[model samples]
Target: MQIKHQVVTRTPLGGFTLVEVLASVALISIVAAYFVHIQIQQVQERVVEALAQDVLTLANASMTYFSQTNEWPDQENGDCDDLIATLGGLGAFPVAVGGYQGPDGITLATRCEDTGDLGRTLLISVNFPFGADDQAQMLMSYLPTSVNEDVDDDEGPVVTHYVATPRRASERYRFYRIALEERGIFRLSKPDCPGRRNDPAHILLPQAICMPASAQGLGGYFFDEIDDDDDYWELQLLVADGEENNNVSDFMEFSGIPTCDGNRVYVGAITYCETR
Candidate 1:
């Protein structure tokens, strides 16, 4: 018998060559690049969605605050700083409908009536990348969700703003009023709207329907806004009647509050306030 020693050798587990390794890496890089592109697109989409929602949220908050205190939120309060508390922070808006951009462009220009108790004015405007421009609609009913009840001091009869319906290149405006139960009691409940369910009226003051037209001062009303704190206003389409004809004519169109097509847009605004 003879003892035999066998020589052992190891072969690499993978049969792949250098070329195969390089090809595999190229494929992986392609896949990775595609994934990165998708991520970027998603981020941009989310930003836009957030902005739209922000517009609606602020609008409703202003409306609700108006209903409770009968006064618009103070433009000077920490809660009232445009774009700072928001993504746009003044520039948050693409365009200034009621806000300012100045010669360069003013965003959110507020006017205080000198009376002190009268409260400061607020004006904001934005443009969707696509939508009808400067059209008119009325806010027959609304639901806003924020306010500061601690601050009280009845300045005037109610909270007022201007909205303008469509008219010639110029000359269109309407007055909008938000009547509050009291000037400093923020109500968490679904607004007092005493007659909304059946009476079929604006929640604020009784009667005094918001209509559309452009005339002189006083009884003559229209829809228009050259700048923040501009004069006049118009009617927002009523969810009940056909005044609005919304058809993608409002800021809330994407939010689904109310439309001529019978949809809802979370967005709301003060389009018309009665003259008296």
Candidate 2:
């Protein structure tokens, strides 16, 4: 019995080394970091969507106010807190929109005016504060294609320094107009028009040039800024009915021609001049 007891022995269990433990920790950290990045991106996307919704809300409210009052909520500069308060008072919001607000951190300044017979028009300018370039680009994508094009082209949209902060290269004020009523037709010079001043029958001549006009003094009319150099406008004549010719020479002689192709025109720079 003494001899059997003396012969008994055992081996120790195996465990991970320090390097293996460190490797496991590194792997976990990487996975955690990846998930965190995804979460941050999702958050950014939501933030952009929320901001866009806020703009849409403000636009709808302003339109409502206009429809009810037959006048737009006055916004001289870009800061629209006063306009917001006015809208809130008119019951534009279910819950009162309080505090100074304008599409997340971006500043909004608008210029509303009665464009004579063009009806009332609202020019909402989106100013991206410093350090908001990425956000501005994202916001632009969310805006209407017409607005996005205006901002992208840089030739259109009167750039105003309503926001005092210095802007980044990518950051700029974006503009879009909301027409509350039907646009009024602008009377072209007698030499440019195809029909006589008193006659209505010759209004739609085959090679006539004409356009819907806005008030001369108001911004966002035919051009955002009608300067001295751009005083005399040269527009392309409209193509006559049943005519297959698309040549520029044929229509070049007409004074009423306004558009470059179908949507834009040159006014110091290429700007939008959508035909009515």
TM-score for each candidate, following the candidate numbering: 0.26, 0.41
Report the C-alpha displacement of residue 63, candidate 1, in angstroms.
1.6
For candidate 1, the TM-score is: 0.26
Per-candidate total of colliding backbone pairs: 47, 8
- Model 2 regions lying over 4 Å from their true place: 1-12, 68-70, 75-82, 94-98, 102-106, 113-121, 126-129, 145-276
Every candidate's lDDT = 0.32, 0.43
Residue 73 displacement in candidate 1 (angstroms): 2.4
lDDT top scorer: 2
lDDT of 2 by residue, 152-195 (tens): 44332322211111112112112222111112122221111111
User: RMSDs, each prediction?
Assistant: 24.4, 19.0
Please write out the lDDT profile of model 1 over residues 1-276, one tens digit for every residue.
999999999986958899999999999999999999899766655544454354455555554544544344453354344422333343333444554332212122222232222223333333222221111011111213212122134321111232211111111122233321221111111211111121111222222323233243223212222223222222232221223334433211111222223422222222222211
How many Å off is the CA of 255 in candidate 1? 61
